[model samples]
Target chain A: DTAVSQTPKYLVTQMGNDKSIKCEQNLGHDTMYWYKQDSKKFLKIMFSYNNKELIINETVPNRFSPKSPDKAHLNLHINSLELGDSAVYFCASSQGAGNNEKLFFGSGTQLSVL
Target chain B: AQKVTQAQTEISVVEKEDVTLDCVYETRDTTYYLFWYKQPPSGELVFLIRRNSFDEQNEISGRYSWNFQKSTSSFNFTITASQVVDSAVYFCAPSAAGNKLTFGGGTRVLVKP
Candidate 1:
């Protein structure tokens, strides 16, 4: 069984189109996160939810929003996607909100804004 | 502020050759956690190892070994007898507080048979 999974493995949309990526984890973790990997392969944290509560919100624009219906799911929605939004979005989960805990990541959703 | 730096951008080696990926970090907090993650072409991030600040001991798991040095704020990963399956992009991440992780630029390793 895949511990962490995300849908829409590949997405290609227009510049002004909006898209959403769904993520689910069966690890029964309390914390879930969304990370963005740019062309340089630099992974940056976008948002984190601990038990459905917003914890960390980076400098990401308001266009990108993360919603976690429960501890097992965290979905990312991007509004008016731009060229810069073309990157790999990864979903991850951990046992708790502790910094030392290991994280299990999904295969990732590749978003391409044309 | 916490930062993880991976100096090597890419490393290519023949099969069975050992390779060491360097990681240096800077953080104000005395207590933090360091981690190593591998991302193959499949785009899945695989957790390799994790080391807490208090644990400076070196650990070995099969062909993978990690060295954590608090004195230099460095946590390095070494792979012995690397195979083609070992080719991947490795990231060094350090988490300070609130479970926030800062990932390095990553080092891509290509193992040629």
Candidate 2:
């Protein structure tokens, strides 16, 4: 079974289009995170939710919002995407909010804005 | 602030050769956690190893080994007899309790067979 899965493995849209990526984890983890990997392969944290509560919010733009319906699911919604929004978005989950816990990541959703 | 630095941006090695990926971290907190993650072409991030600040001992598993040195604030990973399957991008992340991880610029490894 896939411990963490994200829908729409690939997304290509024009500028100003809004799109959402859905993520689900069956590991029963309490914390979920969204990370962005740019062209340089630098992984940066965008947001984190612990038990459906927002725990970490980076310097991401307001157009980017994360919704965690429950502890098992966390989705990312990007509005008015721009060229800079093209990157790989990854969904990860851990047993808890502790830094010691290992993260289980999904296959990732590649977003491309033209 | 916690920061992890991977000096090696990319490394290429032949099969059966040994390669080492260097990682240096800085954190104000005395107690923190360090981790190494591998991201292959498939895009899935695989957890390799995790070490706490208090533990300075080195660890090895099969052909993979990790060296942790709190004095120098370094946690390095080494692969012996590397296979082509080991080609991937690896990240070094360090974090404190209840805080988000700070990942370093990944190091891409390519092992030619």
Return the TM-score for each candidate structure.
0.98, 0.97
Q: lDDT of model 2 at residue A46? A: 92
**The candidate that achieves the highest lDDT relative to the unseen native structure:** 1
Instruction: Give model 2's docking category.
Output: medium
Q: Which ten residues in a row have the lowest lDDT in candidate 1 chain A?
A: A94-103
- Listed for each candidate, the true contacts retained, as a fraction, are 0.89, 0.84
Give candidate 1's error at residue A17 in angstroms. 1.3
DockQ of each: 0.89, 0.80
Query: Model 1, DockQ value?
Result: 0.89
**TM-scores of the first chain across all predictions?**
0.98, 0.99
Instruction: Tell me the chain A TM-score of model 2.
Output: 0.99
For model 2, what is the error of residue B40's alpha carbon versus the real structure, in angstroms, after optimal superposition?
A: 1.0
Model 1 alpha-carbon drift over 4 Å, by segment: none
The weakest ten consecutive residues by lDDT in model 1 chain B span B92-101
